[model samples]
Target: MLFAHDTEASLAAAAELVNTAHETPDGLRTPADVVAFVDRWSYTGRVAGDAEELAAVRAVRPRLERLWHADRDEVVELTNAMLRETRALPQLVRHDTWDYHLHAVPPEADLAVRILVETGMAMVDVVRLEELGRMRICAAEDCDDVLIDLSKNRSRRFCDNGCGNRTNVAAYRARKAGG
Candidate 1:
C-alpha cells in the first residue's frame, strides 16, 4: 500500500469531509447532515448533534481541501500547523475493532478537532513518505472534487463522481459527430 491502511482511510475521510461542503443539496447544511456525515464516516466520538457543532466542522473544510494541492514542503507545514493548533498529544490506542493506531486527541474533543487531528496524523505519514503527489483534485474539466491517488499505479485522475464516465461519453460523442 502507498501508506498504512489507517492513514489511507483517514485521508479518504478527510477528503469526503471537505467535499461534503460542496455538491448540490449541500451535504452538510444542517445538524442532520452532520449526524449523517458522522455516521457515514464512522467517526467515534462525542458529537453534540447541534448546529454549533456542525459549524465547527464546516470551518475546517478549507484547510483540509488545501492539502489536495499542497507540495511536499507545504504539506509538512500545514500538517505541523494543524498538530500544533489542535494541541494534539499522541497516544497509541485500540478501540471498536481497530488495531493499534494513534489517537492524538481525546474522544471528547470537538468533532472538528478530532477530524483535523486525525487528518494531521495521516499527513504525518504522507510527509514522511514523500507521497504528497498522491493527494490530488479531480482532473475532470468541470469537477472540483478532490481525491487521493490510491491506485497501485497512481493512475487515478478524475474523482468517482462519474467524471471519468462522463468525460469518456463526451469524447465518444464528439468522435461520432466528427466521423
Candidate 2:
C-alpha cells in the first residue's frame, strides 16, 4: 500500500466525490444521491438528508477537484484552508470496522464539513510524504474526472468510470481498421 489505509480510503473518497461533479446529469442531484454516497464511503456523521445538505456536499466538489491539478504549494494552501475553515481538531477514533484513525471533527458536525476536513487530513499525509503525484486527472481524452494513482508503480492513467476499458477498446478498433 502506498499510504496508510485511512489515507488511501480518503484519497479514493475524495476522487469519487470530485468525479460526481463531472458525471452526466449531475450525480448528486438529490438527497438520495448524497445518502448513497455517504453510505458507500462509510461516512459516520450527521447527514441532514435534506436539500441544503445536498447542495453543501455538491459545493465541495470543485474545491476538491482542484487538488488533482494543483501544484504542491497550491495543494498545501487549499488543504490548510479546508482545515482552517472546518476548525479541524484531530483526534484518534475507532468506530465500526475502522481501526484507529484520525477524526478532526465531531460526529455531529455538518456532513460537508466532515468531508472537507477528512479529505484535507488525507492530503496532509500525501504532502508530508511527497506523494502528491498520486493525485491525478484522468488521462482519457474525453474525460475530466479526477483519480488517485495508488498503484505501486504509479501506472494508473484513467478514472474508474470505464475510461480505461473504453480507451483500450477504441485503440484496438483503430488498430484493426489500420491493419
Candidate 3:
C-alpha cells in the first residue's frame, strides 16, 4: 500500500466527506444525510443527533476539501489547527476485526471533533512522508470531486466514480468531430 491501511482509510473517508458537497442536486442538507454519511464511513463516536452536530461536520467539509489542492505549508497549518482545536490525545487500540491503530480522541467526544482529529492524524502521516501530492482534485472539467491517488507509479489522475471516463470519452468525441 502507498500508506498505512488506516491512513488510506482516513484519506478515503475525508474525500467522501468533501465530495458530498460537490455537484449534487441537494447538497448535504439534512441531519439524516449526515448520519447516513457517518454510518457509511463507520465513524464511531458520540453524536447528539441534533442539527448542531450535523452543522459542525458540514462546516468541516470545506476545510477538508481544500486539502485536495493545498500547499504543504497550508496542509500543515490546517492539520495542526484541527489537532489543537480538538485537543487530540493519541492512543493505540484494536477493535472489531482490525488490528492496532491510533485513536486520538475518546469515542465519546463530539462526533465532528473525532472525525476531524482522525482525518488530521492521517494527514500528519501524509505531511511527514511528503505525500500530500497524492491528494488531488478531479481532472474532469466539470467535476470538483476529490481523490486519493495511491497507485504505485503515482499515475492515478481522476476520481473513481467515472469522472475520468466521462471526460476522456467527451474529449475523444470532440477530436473525432473536429478531424
Candidate 4:
C-alpha cells in the first residue's frame, strides 16, 4: 500500500467528511447523519450524539480540505495548528477491532477534535514520505470532491463519485457527435 492502512483509512475518512459538506443532500445535516457517518467509518469513541456535537464535527470540513492542494510547509503549519488546537498527546491504543495505532485524543474528546487529530497525524505521514501529490482535488470539471490518490502508478485523476465514468462518457459522446 502507498501508505499504512491506518493512514489510508484516516485520509479516506477525512475526505468523506469534506465531501459530506458539499454533498447534494448535505450528508451531515442532522445528528442522525452524524451517527451514520460514525458507524460507517467504524470510529470507536464517546460520541455525544447531539446537535452541538454534529455541528462541531461539520465545522472541520473546510479545515481538512486545506490539505488537498497545500504545499509541504503549508500542510505542516496547518497540521501543527490542528494538533495544537486539539492539544494532542499521542498515545498508542488498542480498542475494539483495532490494533496498536496512535490515538492523540481521549475517547471522550470532542468528535471534531478527534477527527482533526487523527487526520493531522496521518497527514504527517503524507508529508514525511514526500508524497503530498497523492492528495488532490477531483479533476472533473464539475466536481470539487477531495481525493487521496493511493494508486500504484499515481494515475488516479477523479473522485470516487462516478466522475471518471461520467467524464469518459461525455468525452465519447462529444467525439461521436463530431465524427
Best of the candidates, TM-score: 2
Candidate that would win on lDDT: 2
TM-score of each prediction: 0.96, 0.98, 0.93, 0.96
Between the candidate structures 2 and 4, which one is better when assessed by TM-score? 2
Q: Which runs of model 4 end up more than 4 angstroms from their true locations?
A: none
Candidate 3: C-alpha lDDT: 0.86
For residues 47-163, write the lDDT of model 3, one tens digit per residue: 677889888888989888877778999999999999998999989978876688889999999888888898999999999999988998888887788999899999888887798
List candidate 2 stretches off by more than 4 Å. Answer: none
**Model 2 clash pairs?**
none
For model 4, give the RMSD to the true fold.
1.0
- Report the candidate with higher lDDT, 1 versus 2: 2
Which digits, one per residue and each the tens of the lDDT, describe model 2 over residues 94-173? Answer: 99999999999999999999999999999999999999988888989999999899888999999999999999999999
Model 2 TM-score, all chains together? 0.98
Q: How does model 1 score by TM-score?
A: 0.96
- Superposed on all Cα atoms, the candidates' RMSDs to the truth, in angstroms, are 1.1, 0.8, 1.5, 1.0
- TM-score, structure 4 vs. true: 0.96
